[model samples]
Target: MRFYPATLSRLLAVAALAFSPLSWAEQAISDGVYEIHYNAFNSSFITPEVAQQNGLMRSKYRALVNVSVLKLQDDGSKQAVTAIVSGQAANLIGQAQQLEFKKIDEGKALYYIGGFRFTEDEQLKISLSVQPDPNKPAYNIEFDQRFYVD
Candidate 1:
């Protein structure tokens, strides 16, 4: 499906999550009709204005996980879909913290963001349960990433 330029613009405006240390690709899980995109990065990369606007704390020890769900239309366009998402992040030391997601609905561009704490050079396993439709089962997502304080 075609991910519109406007959608990216809005997502960046709201989340500003694309700014990472250098480069980090957003991973996607697809089930033909639906696609879930997610990623995690240090929140300090976020601009101060945007972080405050979103009521988020920017710190070296803090990170953010971003999730977005979309549906593929017949026209090859991607339409943002509302979803039920819950998750948690666990460090290698078995320290698990529940991720409380806050939905950012921009009408056509929707996303869920969760914040967590970590130390320098710490690795975290993030798992999320995403249900794009109440009638369907939730998609289980798990991934690992290392965060740095720099």
Candidate 2:
């Protein structure tokens, strides 16, 4: 079998440049400012007076999150913020331009805060609630920081 049309058009241009999608879209995720970490857990450890004495309206959880982007390289060295974690919710996590909280310090168990800047890239929907009898969860946790300018 002799087939030659410039060798079948060079084997179909090397199989269309090896099945290109622009070579995997240049590893996506670009358009910076990202620093997000969220955690939610209730693997049947339900304790809100035992989930309202077993009347449990709704309680089931497991959410672990992390997203980082703090690459400041001009002199003041700081380059350790390259993250990705999902239980869902993270197209860019709050899309940051600014989300200041820079420091709260105090951790032996858990309380070490510093959250700021989230230059948007879209896809960040978060909703969490837990309250029962003067325990906690009155409402105070909101974030929506999206930025993409130059």
Best by lDDT: 1
Per-residue lDDT, model 2, residue 109, is 14
Put down candidate 1 lDDT per residue, 1-150, tens digits, no spaces: 344335533545344344443234547889889999888777777667666666777898998888899999999899999999999999988889999998877677788889999988887899999999999899999988888885
How do the predictions measure up, each by TM-score?
A: 0.84, 0.18
- Please provide, for model 2 over 58-96, each residue's C-alpha lDDT reduced to its tens digit, 9 standing for 90 to 100: 223221111223344567554544222212232343332
lDDT of 1: 0.80
Minimal lDDT window, size 10, model 2: 104-113
Each prediction's whole-model lDDT (CA): 0.80, 0.27
For model 1 the local lDDT of residue 50 reads 66
What's the CA error at residue 28 for candidate 1, in Å? Answer: 0.4
Error of 2 at 91 (Å): 14
Off by more than 4 A, model 2: 1-28, 32-60, 75-150
Pick the TM-score winner.
Answer: 1
